[model samples]
Each structure stands twice: as structure tokens, then as C-alpha cells.
Target: MRRSRAADPRGRAADRGSRTVTLTGLVAATALTASLTAACGGGTSTDTEGGNTDPKTLTYWATNQGASLEHDKKVLTPELKKFERQTGIKVKLEVIPWSDLLNRILAATTSGQGPDVLNIGNTWSASLQATGALLPFDDKTFAKIGGKDRFVPSALASTGTAGKDPAAVPLYSLAYGLYYNKARFDEAGIDEPPATWSELVAAGRKLTKGGKYGLAVEGANLAENSHHAFVFSQQHGGDFFDSEGKPTFTTAANVKAVKQYVDLLAGDKIAAPGNAEYAQNQSLKDFATGKAAMLLWQAADTTLKSHGMKPGDYGIAPVPVQSGAPGQGRNVNSMVAGINISVFKNSDNLDGALKFVKFMTSDTEQKHLNSTYGAIPPVKSAQDGGTFSTPAQKVLRETLATSAAPLPQVPDESKFETLVGTAMKELFADAAAGRQVTEKSVRDRLAKAQQQMQS
Candidate 1:
């Protein structure tokens, strides 16, 4: 995630916007990347990674959850060492990159050679569940990992589709928050973070003076674009799919959502024109380096610190809503974002894998790992007024508990992220070129995207 996402620093090291990486990782993943296209349509194989019959040994695949592949290894080696000491079980770990994680998992699902346990993006729970590759956590399974009550209710919601066994368990809980430069706000005579959409635009205008921009947007980053699009659509009372799981990309409220988000650049002029092509952590860089006064990001504290912007340099607040304060249902400002850990159904070491999951989600490990990554631990009791008590974590925690909503638990959800996200990317490019991003233009783009799905 910069899984917490793309090449982001250690908090989830990026955002759900980063997709399947850190939450950024590398290695074996190279081979998996090569066969993703083929694996998608391949018939399921009875083959599995059943080589290691030794009861004490297990294999694990983890998304890069730190500043770099090496950083993740450095942080995890010690924990694995500790785990090895406690139980004679040894976990051979392979860190996979975000760009290749999904492909690899798909390949594994098709081939039945996936590791005993691996991390997945929470949003992908339903899609992966549809594959039947992941081990479902039923009531009995939950009992293996300290019971379902141990995790937060909100965090557990994204584990899979409703009325089914969860394909995974929440590992690191994340939610979007508006991160603002305090000095810039204070100098601009702004007192508090924006509460409503109107106030956000107004505050942005004040911070948009001089060479520095008011807000940083990851316009070309498909996942970031989709995450924001989803949140905005929710605030506008829209859904990407109907009850039958059909794409509803161009609904009236949806069109409004895309327009409002895109208008941050096209209509408002608060974000920089160059932001249209930012797929990498360039937006995060802008916020960290003082080039932008505000950023809407997930678990960005550690990443900002990596850029030398300390905790005191910025303030975190709930992402603004369309009208009143942030809340459930319509007024949702953040999507439930984070990583989920799951065991493979074909794992040779099922018992060992379950033990590993229990160990990883243990109260002690949750505090240790989430603290290092700057993510809020999904385990309810893991958060014990320590590292998570800070203002940033506080806001993210509150948002997840109250305002955040899960992405639609449909198999086409990933497609929705891609199509609408790409459409928004195109709209941002048009805006960068000074094109009028009107209602018709927005609807046209969405209609085309929806058509791509329906066809």
C-alpha cells in the first residue's frame, strides 16, 4: 500500500491507491508477473504447493509494507525470528511488489501453488473470494484466530461479500484523511481544516496563493483516482453497481461525483496543472515538501516523515463531505482501505498457516507491525492508546469507525476501479489542457466506461 500501496513509505508504505504492493514488495514474484495474462483464463489446476509436508515449516508471501523491499525484509526478519523462537515453525518469506502481486495471486489461484499465507488488498476480497482460492474464515475458522469479536466490525466488513464466509481477515486497517500543512494554513489565516465541501474550496483558495498549490491530487494514479471517485460517489449517494451487480457508472449522482472530484483541478484551479499525470507518490512528495498545502491520503504519516515533514508540520482531519459533517451512508468521505491476510485453500500446511495468521494478528504483533507502518491495527484491542493515539491516527480511526464505507463487494469492482479511474485520468488530462469539464463531458466519459463493462 504504497496494499497500504505503490512504492509509498512505510504506513500500509503508501495508500490503497498503491494497490497490491507494500501492503511495495519484490522476488519469485518476477515469475508470477510473467504469466498473469495466461492465468486469468486458465482452467483451475489440482496442483498445489504441497511440497513442504514438514509440520514445522510454512511459506509466506507478504506485500512490501515498508519504504522499500529491503526495508520490509529488515522490519519483518526480526518478527519472523521472534515467531520462530516461540514456535518451532519457520516461515520462508517472499516479498512481492504491488505491480505483480495480483498477477502472482491469480497465477497461484489458477495453478494452486500459492503460499500458505499471503496479504491481499481488502477491496479485492470479493473478487478473490469468487476464485475460491482463498480459505474462508467461517465461525470455526474465526475461533482459530481469537474469534470474530477480536477485530473491528468495520474492518471485518471488507473481508468478503455479504452473506458469505470472509475470504480473509483484516490485517492493517486504513482510511483516507485530509493531510494539511499547518504552517501554510496558519500563514493563510485559516483556523481549522475544512468541514464541508464549500469550506474546503474556500480554504483551498486561500492556500492557493503564491507558487505553492492548495491541494495535491494523484490524477493519473488509477487506484487513487478510483478511491476518490468512490468516496465522492458515496457522498453524492451513488453506487457503481446495482443490486444485480450491473455497472451503473453513469448515474446522475455518479456523474456529479466525478465532476466534483475532477473539478478540483478543472473548475476550482486549486491543484497544479501538472498533477494530471501523477501516478507515483509525486502528490505525496508535493505535500511533504511544502509544494502543496493539502493532500487526501491514506496512512501517510510515516511517508511524510520519510520526506522530512515531521508530525508537527501537518494536521490531519476527516475528508470533507458534500454538506454536513462526515457520517455513514451519504456523507461518506473515505473508503475502507487496508490490507487483508488470507491463507490459501490449497496450502499444504493449513494448520501451520492458521497458526501463523493467529500469531500475526496477535495483540502484540498487531501493535508492533502496524506501529512500524503507521497503520491502525484492525484488531480492536491492539489499539491501546500508544502509537495510534496521535492526531493523524485518531482522525483515521474515527473515520473508519464512523464514516468510511467498503467498496461494492462485486467481482467487477476491480474493473470499476480501472475503467472509471482511467476515464477520470483522461478528464484530468483534458482539464490540464484547459478543456471545459462540463456535465455532458463527464457523463460522456462515464457512459463510455460503463459501455466497456456492459459489452
Candidate 2:
């Protein structure tokens, strides 16, 4: 499932082509540190003891980005072996599932018992950086892992606040894409993927029949729901936060977006009635099983193939925009950073870990690993020269370049996820249960959620 969440293989061509936004400042360090400590339910320690003192050995925790843990090991062993041969450093790699990664990371940060290097979801980068538990990539440290400019600007921006040394660097990059089953489209007599929200609904109406939904959605997973909300809000020319980084979930644009999202089920009835309980995996399964005709996802190619859906069965396109909105038709997309690499501050093998980081992002490794995982490589060089061989990868690269924005980089990002996601979940529930979800009702719910954040 690491591959499912870590690198969906559904979106983004290359990180370099993505739009970049500069996030200027961070919440006060003291407050951020305290927030992380409280959230993780752990106290930080400065202990650097018990680390492998041998310059030849390093520990790494890799997210499950392959078919399985064993598959990841098979893919990574040779690469690590190559690194050892060249740098004389032996890496002990542990492939962790997405379900256990965050907890394990918290335990390691609190107890100083963890790998020297690890992969984390980029969305968690700022939250983890606030803990002061990550080894930051400063000027000196960055020099060891190739220069800062070697990374994709947009990908690097997700690692930390602008003007601050980031605690991680983008490893694999991703972007959102509209995935539609070609067979289903043909069956429905649809000639092309929907280019606008209205057209999408119209197509959905045609695609929905014989117990098959027009679209699949992840309503139960708050994180995924929040991601969709972010995209919809942006398409409506609204964002979750204001210019000052304060929550603005109840803005008119946001309410409209949320209403439109909920209307897909409540008003349009294009999605399955039971979809309110669906998570990302479940929705993806529904799509794979032909229960849905369209899905918006990123980096899902390998997983889709594993699910028995071949590349030719599905087509990838940019997510549609609101045609009548202020920025309608403007290229805009969800905030997506596939997976990022971070070094622990308490690692006994800092030098070795840095070496591994550099090795992982190197052109050769980037190409090999990303190719195996069916994801976009974060390095510019790896993406050029026909490195992305598939049509989906090519489409994603162009989408990232023209669209893609990162989630808000506020210190309270997790709070935003919980609040906005929960609100969306409630809306979905209301729609699923045949309740009315008017504009005022949506505004009221968002207002309540925003108040909870402030409180």
C-alpha cells in the first residue's frame, strides 16, 4: 500500500515543469516545536547515542513504493549495493507500510531509535520539520547532496517554509490527473475527457448506468477529501488560507466549490450511494473493477497495472476546471509532492546518510527507481531525454508545468487537513443520506470548522 499512497503513478510528468510558490515565513519555532511534540505525544531528546559509529553502515526506512515490501527490497537492494560499492557505505533498508510510517517516525524522533534516512509524505514535511527532529539541509549539508538548484523548485518548496533550510528534499514528484477508462467512455459514446466541470457532470450522467458510477470518490479518507477540496477551491479562485496564512474555509468561493463537490452525489447522483464510506484505496479499487468510469488521482499506473488494468485501458487528462469561475480554464491543480527524503538529526551516520540521500537523487538512481515505481523523478535530468516513456507520464509532466500548486505551508497544516476534511466528510454524509446541502448550509459548516481551528 506504500505504492498506493506514496507514488500513485497517475500524475505529473516532471517536477521542474511544475509551478512554484514561495512561502515566506513559518510559525514561531517555539510554538511549532511544542505543537509537534504535543501532536506526536512524545518528548524530544538530544541523545545521539546508540547510532552505528561505523562509517560503513547506515540505516534507512523506505516507504513501500513498489508492489510489496519484498518487491521494494528487490528494487532497492541493487541500488544500495551499488552505493556501497562506490562509497564504501553499507545501508540497512527497512520498507515500512504507509499505515505504520508516521507512528514509527514519531517513536524514533522521541526515542532516538530509527533509521538514519527515511521517506516521508511531502505533506508531512513541514509538520515534522517543526519538531526540530529532522536534520536540515543547510548550505553545507546541501553541498554534500548536490547543490540546492539540482532539485525541482516546486518540489523543494514543499520541504520547508520559504527562506528556511528545509528538513528534506523531494525524492519522487507527482501531480493530479483525471483518469478515465477508455472503454467506458466509448461505451457511453463520449469522444473525449471532460474539459470543464459542466461537461464532466454531463459525461457522468451518460456514464452512470447498470450499477456503474460515473466517478469514484474517497469520502472516508479525510486527507484525500481535503486534497479534492483544495483543488476545487483553487479552481474557484479561493484557497483554504488567506494571504496571512489564516484559515479562510468559509469564503464564498470555498463554499461554492464545496457545494459543487457535494452536489456530485446529492444533486447529480453520479457517484455510488455507498461512496460516502470509500477511502482512496476503495475508490481506486472501484475504478479498477469497472464500478466507476473516472477517477482523479496521481501516480497510480503501477497499482492500476497490478490490479489487472492495462495502460491502454485508461487515459489520463488534466482535471477539469469551473468554466464560469473567475479563473475558469486557467491551469490549476491539487498540491502534490509524491515522496520526500529526510535525514534524522540523531543519526549516528550523518555522513553516510547524506551520501545515501545524494545517491538516491542522483540521475541514475532517480531514473531507475522512478521507472520501477512508475513515478515522475524529481530531478530535472532524469525527466529529460525520453526518461518518461509512457503517455500518462508525459501528460502529467505537462500538467505539472502548467498547473500544480502545493498545499498551504502553514505550521497548522494538519489542523487544516482535519478541519476541512471533516467538514467535507460531513457534507458527503449528508448528501449520501438524502439530506439537503444548500449554499448557506455549506457556509455554516465551513464557518464552524474554521472557528474550531481558531479555538
Top TM-score model: 1
Candidate 2, 1-455: lDDT as tens digits: 11214222111222111111111111222133522321111123233352445678878887766546787789899999999999998888898766556657766665556777888767666666777878889999899988888887777877866667998998888777789999999999999999788899999999999999999876655666666677788887789988788889998889988888878887888989798877446676788778999987776666677688887899998788777333454447656647788987767677778889999999999998887776778788889756586777887787656677777766666556656767878888988888998999899989998897787
Instruction: Evaluate model 2: give its lDDT.
Output: 0.71
Could you tally the backbone clashes for each prediction? 20, 12
Candidate 1 per-residue lDDT over residues 1-455, each given as its tens digit: 32333111111233433552321111122222212322111123333543335667777888766556777788788998888898898888888866567777866765656677898777777767776667889999999988999999988888888999999998888878888999999999999999887888898888897888899997877677777878799988888899988989899989999999999999998999999988756788899999999998877765677788898899989999988853534878788888889987767667778888999999999999888887889998999876989877888899989988888777656556667877999999999998899999999999998997665
> Model 2, poorest ten-residue lDDT window?
16-25
lDDT against the true structure, each candidate: 0.76, 0.71
- Model 2: how far is 330 from its true place, Å? 4.9
